[model samples]
Target: MASPLRFRRSSERWNDDRIIEELYSHLDSNLGARSVTPHYVGPDGFETRRFEMDNGDMALFTWNDDFAYWLGNTETPPALWRTSKYTFDEVPYQIARWGQRELLADLTVESPWLAKYDYLSWFFLPVLFSKDGRETSRAFFRKYDAGFPDTTRDEALSFYERFLRTGALDDYRYTMASKLGTSQYFDKNRMSSAMSEFTVAKLLTEAGYDVIPEIEVTTGHSLDFRADPRNGSHDQSSLVEVTRPQPPTQRAADTPVAALRETAETKSNGQLNEHGGGAVMFVDCSGFRDDEWSAVVGEQPDVRHRPAVVFRARPSGAIDAYKKGSVPLSLSQAVEWV
Candidate 1:
């Protein structure tokens, strides 16, 4: 894969002269230079200018609303006030530093690439503050607006490519909550559960496993949470069964377990009669309780087989595995199981 590209600082700088030159180059052919005039500079360092297009339209630019306030003066010179009544309202078009930052922040929140390369802040400031600030701002905004959809399309394509290469796009999505107007941290258990399931399914599909989810096997009238359809023919079939948080003790006698076992046995027999015998494996993920495990084995179990995996509720919160003599799985260990 290619390394990520960086946006250069030198490419982002903008100044008054450069802005004026660019605008002149753009408008010169249509509106002759003779029609353009430099008026006055403001106390805040913004240049006020006026221009007449060849088509006879007039426009003005200034830093603050001083020009507008002056034009409203009843005693002001009629010549100045005459055109002042026609003055373009540049105050609304003027960009403040904070406003520019806010705009960049909004864009960064939506487009990961902008934030990824740290180019949003550099790009927005000049566009919002240059001499032709209004035009620059409009152009920049429009460019991003037009490009966003394509950027999103490109991201989707990239995710698909990664999926094909890695058999899983584990980091493609995220979820979070908010409290007191602040974003709450992710719940690790919830995130792990979702990611594990998604990654497993994606990998299986990529591997040509003919995977199915929540499949209903007719022989035992049981719903298999997941299955690989390619494992068997009509008479004989092999399948893997997964159980999570083993049925609660309250429902220990649920018929699902019996039904699953029956399906596996029947499928094995059918396959054996038709071709050869097949094996079915059941993976039980009912993690052990710390206290129960310690009482049974007299010590803590290995980190990989810790029981906290079964009862995890929040990813950011700690589990009390110590109470039951069990331990939580490390991230690396969890990934291995997945």
Candidate 2:
């Protein structure tokens, strides 16, 4: 696998002209799948560039203030892909730094020959940031777009299944969220649920819990995850069910906060009852009233097994594991479970 050329901010003196030459030279040499050419270097000191990807689609970027912001596709309107930026000091193109590490492994398994150019992450960045990022990405890379090029729904599923056979779960997640910008599959409520689950899953993984998504327990019941505690070995595994109250936009103009809490509780109760155990329920309290949230958290789930503790996921990503809990855990705290 080829390693993408990495750039970092350094105190070393930089020759602007020489640096631009090296960058363009590197792209031309490394990008075997794409034709990279210098578009123009503006007098204002920003360098504009264009890339024609493997599938013949083109995108543009400009390097300014040590950051590269994608302009847009060759012919597409700016209305689709918002201007997304990448800094030279950080891993380029990826929304999260952790993704860079995973990307290397993905490239090894999927396209080892392309590994050399993986560092040219910008080659893939624009499409992923656009409204139809996923679609454009798939099209540009010659991957099967879910519903395009006259492919039927069944054929699309087959392509999806094949891809899922090797694609990482996190990739699926990132891709799904990107695709949701234009997908019909996720409406308001479903999008809320998806976001809550994704947030909790990310936090759990950060906290060193071996978390699995949508682990099925019974015939019709699937919990969000069957999580192993911080330590690799644990006597008992935990089933975690996550839910979020109505999003701010979805709430009725006249709906009281109490009604929203009730709605959240109902969803939590269903999971607790079906799971019938000490499964922990994580409720996202993003838009719930303060008093309503307190009341909801104060009440416990009544189940045949032991009662469950309801944790509130605050708007700022902090976790209130329980009412009056002393030790609050940050999303990235993975050393030990709080």
Models 1 onward score TM values of 0.22, 0.41
**Across residues 63-105, which tens digit of lDDT does each residue of candidate 1 receive?**
3323322211012222233342221112233322322333345
How many clashes does the backbone of model 2 have? 3
User: Of the candidates shown, which would achieve the greatest lDDT relative to the real structure?
Assistant: 2
User: Which runs of model 1 end up more than 4 angstroms from their true locations?
Assistant: 1-108, 111-161, 164-185, 216-338
At residue 19, give the lDDT of candidate 2. Answer: 43
Highest TM-score, which number? 2
Clashes of each: 9, 3
List the pairs of residues colliding in candidate 2: 2-115, 2-116, 4-119
